[model samples]
Target: MKDCEFFFESKENVEQDGRVILDEYRTHLKDKNTREDINDNELLEKCINIVFEHMKYNRVYIYGIGSSSVVAREFKLRFMRLGLDVDYLAESHSIRMNITRVNQESLVIGISVSGKTEEVIEGLREAKEKGAKTIMLSAARVYEYRSYYDELILIGGLKNLAISDKISPQVPALIVVDILYSHYLNYNNDNKKEKLQMTLEHINYELEE
Candidate 1:
């Protein structure tokens, strides 16, 4: 039998290597302009208006799979805390099954960075057929699926660099989410701030227990 030997780098060397990796990551991110492209004030304002209109009288259903699903869940939680009737389905099967609940009085948001997820496209298509307002967040302008969604919010970044795989795929979508959330906080006077406060307090209380 032969004995196995293991070697570990010193803390100083490990930290130096980690710093180099982080520096490269930051450089790549800086070179990426996806967020800048989405920072169009006019477009974002229009989207805010559309979402607020639908939210006033309808329920919200967000759908996404894989990394996009993470964005959907975060959006749901943030809006829910603001006292909005919002929910999310991250799995293809769940989205298909619960999609029946969507109707004219519903707002469906599909997050697909690549703009080619079949499940996301199908979900938006069905929602449109049911007379629900549909919105899509994607990096690519998928002209083929134009009829499926009422609004298309284009995500910005390196379209050719496959940045999502190297970093977080949901970064661009999350930027839009935060923008919408801020708009809602400023525009709505439905005691949403109070609701947010209460939700935060509840979470803290739970944590302290």
Candidate 2:
């Protein structure tokens, strides 16, 4: 009868808070969207050229936490499928030891919703110190270490929440990472566009069924 009761009854079928948040996130995509969308798209365009210029060496490192880390993994997989050398650093020990040094030509892509995440920031810091080209995907403004990074891609504007946050913020962050994937496709002359386009056409055709 009630929402809580329905949730309890369907506990096995229904997912918990994480799923709820993700579902709400998907739904929020249908909504009009917020200011973050514009900035994020801009960042995507700016990074595409740089990514293309260094297509060689092929090594890429991604850093982030929580959902942001999952997003980074998806980006890494997309790059890998496109034949680039991609690596993931989501843990404390691996991040510290594995990424100790990076090739000068390598690209280190860092994604952080808060931009204030200590681990990702520190990892990026290390990568930079070791001579890797650093690129940041963050919603927060550039901080004191601005000179250390090669590029900072800002996604989403600020939106404060009291008790619970609206989905308006989360979806745009996801979309920004997706935009990076799209940008890679466009930059590398990859068939992801035609492939995705064809897939969408098929989906639409099937929906008609």
Candidate 3:
């Protein structure tokens, strides 16, 4: 079944070993990836604007565990550079215990590939009960966790991709983040550029010490 899909076709001008060509399989996966991202744009933008608006008057929190937690951490790092106060918790129990702090102005993001991580789902549920805005990023189709989420972004199930894409959730997760980063950059390109420069300089100065 996997053999039937093709993301890149050999051009007449190109000649290479099949092994070398196989190494470029990422090119094929990425073509399919772009289409996957296109389907999520409307929801992604809505969620991004919601987050940006919340940041203006409130706070942003992200929760996840395992490799999905890694994605949450990356999301935090990127947005923090834009000067948003973003907090990422890779521990599920911590999020659940502390979620009482979330309110209507708070935007809570839950990142999990399976969308069934007990701790993650529980934490999101708590945030919802507290009246915070919630977003879920997962590779899984909407499931029981959907009830607790205000918005959902399905990353098109990387499992459907070739063998190379099946092992990691980070691939699709990061793709979505890259798009969100672009949205942030586009929303305030000039101001963000200046602030990013200042932040980089400050970090560098601290590191040099």
Write one digit per residue (lDDT tens) for candidate 2, span 11-84: 86656756876866555444343344434565667677666655666578888666676767777766665555
Candidate 3 residue spans exceeding 4 A from truth:
1-34, 37-39, 160-166, 188-190, 205-209
Off by over 4 Å in 1: 1-36, 159-164, 205-209
TM-scores, all candidates, are 0.81, 0.68, 0.77
Q: Write the per-residue lDDT of candidate 3 for residues 18-103, one digit (tens) a residue.
A: 55545544553566654675366678789878887887877798998888888899999998888888988888568767676788
Candidate order, TM-score descending: 1, 3, 2
lDDT of each: 0.80, 0.67, 0.76
Q: Could you report the Cα RMSD, in angstroms, for every candidate shown?
A: 4.0, 6.6, 8.3
**Window of ten residues with lowest summed lDDT in model 1:** 1-10
lDDT at 88, model 1:
91
C-alpha RMSD between model 1 and the true structure: 4.0
Q: Please list all clashing residue pairs in model 2, or write none if there are none.
A: 36-156
